[model samples]
Target: MHVVAHTEQPLQAHALIRAAASQPALLPLAQQLTDQCWGLLPGVHRLRFALRGDVPQNTHPASPPLTRDRLSLTLCVGPHADWPEFAEVLRAHTTGACETPVELAALQARIVTIIGAGVAGAGTARALAERGWQVTVLDAGQAPAAGASGLPVGVVAPHTSHDDSGVSRLSRAGLRLMEQTMRELLIEGVDWGCTGVRERRLPGKTRRAGVPLSWLNEHAHTANDWTHKAPPPAPDDAFWHPRGAWLKPAPLVRALLAHPNIHWQGNAKVEALRFIPHEAHLSHASTNTARWQVLQGSTVLAESSRVVLAAGPGSAALIATATEDGSAPRINPLRGQISWGLMADLPSGAHMPATPVNGHGSFVHKLASPEGPAWYTGATYDRIHGDARLLDSDHAENLERLKALEPDTAAALAPLFATVGSDAPRVHGWAGVRCGVHDRLPMMGRVPHAPEGLYMNTAMGSRGLTLALLCGELLAAQWHGEPLPVEGRLAQFLSATRFRSNA
Candidate 1:
């Protein structure tokens, strides 16, 4: 539902004419946008429209409601040389509101410091950088995605429930954003793929009730694009996700960190964070000069008027350091291991899946790797302690889960597990620890009980690839007062303060 159009002439002079000629019905909206478009600056501008329909509104909550564009229009007023800057930039300029807010005119420093170089931090850094913010990403590791996002390969798919839960809707929005980012950045087959996934629902795996409401029935066709029935041993429980994709998290993280406005500083582990107040003066009496200082012992690593803490498992301790109450949200470490091997290692006539499959555990086949074209599966989840090391017991656990997810494929690959003596396809294991909260949703927005500029984007659990990009966009949208990428109600679920409201 995205379109790209270019214009070489004076945009303001002929915008209405072009719009009016093509879609006469939208003349009024075009005129409204044109009239409010006063700043013809040499940068990016977003003019939004909230167009409501004349159709009858839904009377009850049981039936699904039909919605319209929740519209937006972007205009780049610059020369050809500046097209690249204008095209990629998305500033929260114009308020995108009916009545523009005056506060947006008076601005603070645009520099922001993001702690973490994984998908969560890099994603947020990229979102802010695209909006003209100078972003500094700090990481304890030698390079980015060294944490849980270091998973060799992962899947992106929408979550579904009988009632269409908040996580379900938010996941769909995340997948859309992920796809958009992949198209803009990363290699198609090597870094990622939109190859549809087949999900096999098994006993005690599917979350559903006895009956589905009319709301589900009404959106079935639209949902088909995201997920649809696929023929399998149990057709009723099987679903095919057209938008689903296999993603190499490290590559995407690197791409996000590659934005011109983002500067990455590795091995700069933040020991503590403190909000330093600016001294009042007669010449400059504003409170905008205050900054959050990132500290390691006595040395200050960096300082910014705005700060985002996306350090994954390291976020809780940082929040506790900065907050007055000395309390932080409960983010527990969930360790997991994924098993993989080269495709060439498999013996002749070995069963191979055409596409990725997910249910009890996920199996991604024929993905490009340093060794060769490889297949991956397993990812046993366990409570984390100290370091998350790859275990032989966990490898056995993965094989058992694979047996349930794809019995034929698991049976075929079972021999490879014992190929330790020979140079045959040997099973390799990778383990990492992912953080999560009591509620499955990610923790986003400004950190409660903390300083004004302090924010958080973490605890994505196993949905890092699926939701990280969207979380970054959501954080940037909330910061810039832009229209949310997802519904407003669904966004409230991700608020960092949802569990600590009193704080």
Candidate 2:
């Protein structure tokens, strides 16, 4: 193995070492450096040392002594004037001696274009950039979170099934990864929370009857024993999820796209993908160097060797353009609406719950708003296309569900109900469209029989918050030939190729 280190300032070099030491992924390398008693040597110092034994003494005047079986280390001081050279050397050492796949190895220091500024696109860009790839994100809208991710608040929780099904397992894994990401990147209380969620069993719903309360409480939570005496009086048995929380999606999306290697371009909608053959570019160009031109009508938006289509519903059209057969996955638009009202609008005796309640409809308590403390509820799901307009009927439906779920709270807020959706000062809301597939699972991975560099991460449906980051990690892992963040079977389950047979 070989290791190379470089930095302009001595303090920067030490900081790099400290950072590596603290990172769980690089701690082993840090330990090796510690055992070798490596110091801040001036200029460039090359050493050959064994990992299993003591450091070897210098034997040659011009070169450091080499043990029978040892790794080589090189340290370069001063500014990195030639970044390309440094990146190549760093890539070579990190990838080891030709062990990395030829295709993945060629992608090092290359550029990748991601279309979409939503959670999926931003997450994918962040992952690729973290691996040293230059990532450019282009969106049709003027800024990030212009799609379904533009919602005011979204809940994050692992799905539960009686048999621990594939969706359940995948969601559990995704939830864990998302929680870790929030801890590392988001501000607690402001950006997100672990305040827990109360799921009320709807009337006549018996799907959870066979499941044990202890199991539900352990995996999700029945009640916060420390804070509340009993579960909310809505369901036969209200289930509590301590790990579940709500987040402001826009902030998280911005934070993910803030990476130094990621470049965000708004209003650069990609209308189509034109695959350029490797032979067309150059007679002997590497297959991995195949390029694709992203187009906006007749204009070319950008060109790159790699492209990730994560534009939600818009991804299906791009995939169709790239395919020779003009075939694309069946991505349907599911319209949803959420209703919110000021906290002061509640009747004199009516009060909001301390925690969010989820049943046929979901309710969030005391979300901080510019106007004042506000509560949000409802989110009517309808299979409608191109209907972003808010409907008073949907608002009424949401109120009905809330009345069924929490009669006390509903009765208390009766005063606001008379004026709901009539431009009432106390009542407000927003609506957006979410994309979903027939199977309810997200479509991800390389697009089959399309361009070699084309990939898709779409149809996330309502679980975008929980699944986007994990899917991005999976895509980057596959592209880099690294160990997958998810199991092989699960990755296969989410593959975009699954729909090809049907198409």
Candidate 3:
């Protein structure tokens, strides 16, 4: 069982006083409890107390072992304690673990239908499948990572702010979780590289001036690395993140969807959702069994009591249809294009930086590919453009931005441009549309007022590579009634209900 200790201000002392005043026989024990717990750290602690005559004192062999039950107490001893998060944790522990309808019929198998086969959908599939639920993922694309997640290499790093905003904290937590996941699932150095990242500050930006560099070092820096000192070849003002890395999303998505309980159906476009109520002849108890149907045009594609909409820009339309509310949160489609070139084209001793660098545009070092060693750089962002077709103009725009960001690297590639012409490098690139909510945060949790079984986990923008796994875990935790991996405030910030008028 869980209990929250009244450790705020005079509450601790007041509890002790009330206990002693009400029961004079327990005065000594109440005083001892106060002395032992009044100054503990701010975290969950286990407490045990022996009650007189609670167990027999006999030492017989057949006598049951001393019966002991552990009490989990959440202690907050400082003014900075997150009360809302503490309350949520307390609620989860006290209410027991297990979601509603899934546990209603314990003998029957549970099934969940997830739409979309990108990172978000694949990650959610893995989470649910690991919990013994049969999950089937449907996607309109021919294969997974056929959307924004199809990027060859994407950076995974924590965001930092002077005030440590919600986005920063969430990204920090997400980065840690992603790092742990990569270690467990993907092959090191091949599928992912923890080569660290360098963030170059703009010429006039001063938001991070007064912030202590130690904060970044403590949170994301390795033991051997120190903050405030730029590594060789990078600008002196560039901030280094030792824990940052570059990941290949396709492999990660495939690995996540490889679970035995997960099934994938490609080229299956989900057109609409329907909530089918139980028939009148069915028993009242079975009425609580929710049913959702996934439709493609007039054809029924799939159905289950649980459904998750994670199809990026396509989720907004589905949500609007499912909830029958046209005012659902708007997910904007933002087009992005990334340019790449063969690393062998550069001069043999060219000063190509070993790590990924982020400034006006980002550059990734040589990564092994089927063709040969390749380098990625310049993902031009255009919010007004929604077209998925690749453009030579966009590729040129990427190279231009890269030239401004790293002049030396651009100069070193002059030979390649001379040999193959500038247009050759611009032709090799990829383009995709990324989804973004109006608030610029991911939309997660149950769809607002839509049935209990309907949910969403999309609109991740460009951070899908960094935030998808953690958000998936968060959704799974809520669905299973498990302790959340992130704080309650962060979860609420990304909640689907945030778009509701009454919320």
How well is each residue in 347-376 modelled by candidate 3, as lDDT tens digits?
778777768877667888779888788888
Q: Per-residue error at 442 for model 3, in Å?
A: 0.7
Candidates' RMSD to native: 11.3, 11.9, 9.8
lDDT of 1 by residue, 1-503 (tens): 11112344334435644565466555655555555443222333334444454423335443334345334444444465555533333322222112223433334668899999999999999988976799999999999998998999998887876666788767876776687678668999989998988887877864542212532465454446667667665347677887899999999999999988999999988999999866556356455476799999989999887889999989999999999998888888888988888889888888777788887789998888898899999788888453568777777888888888888889998988776335653998898889988887899989988867799999999888888878888898777655456545667898888884523
**Candidate 2's TM-score:** 0.76
The TM-score of predicted model 1 comes to 0.79
The most accurate candidate by lDDT is 1
User: Could you tell me the lDDT of residue 1 within candidate 2?
Assistant: 34
Per-residue alpha-carbon lDDT of candidate 2 for residues 72-162, written as tens digits (9 for 90 to 100) = 4555545566333445555655555224568877653479999999999999998889767899999999989899888888888766545
Which residue pairs show collisions in model 2? Answer: 221-240
Each candidate's TM vs. the true structure?
0.79, 0.76, 0.77
Error of 3 at 160 (Å): 0.5
Off by over 4 Å in 1: 1-107, 209-216, 232-236, 281-288, 419-425, 501-503
Q: How many backbone clashes does candidate 2 have?
A: 1
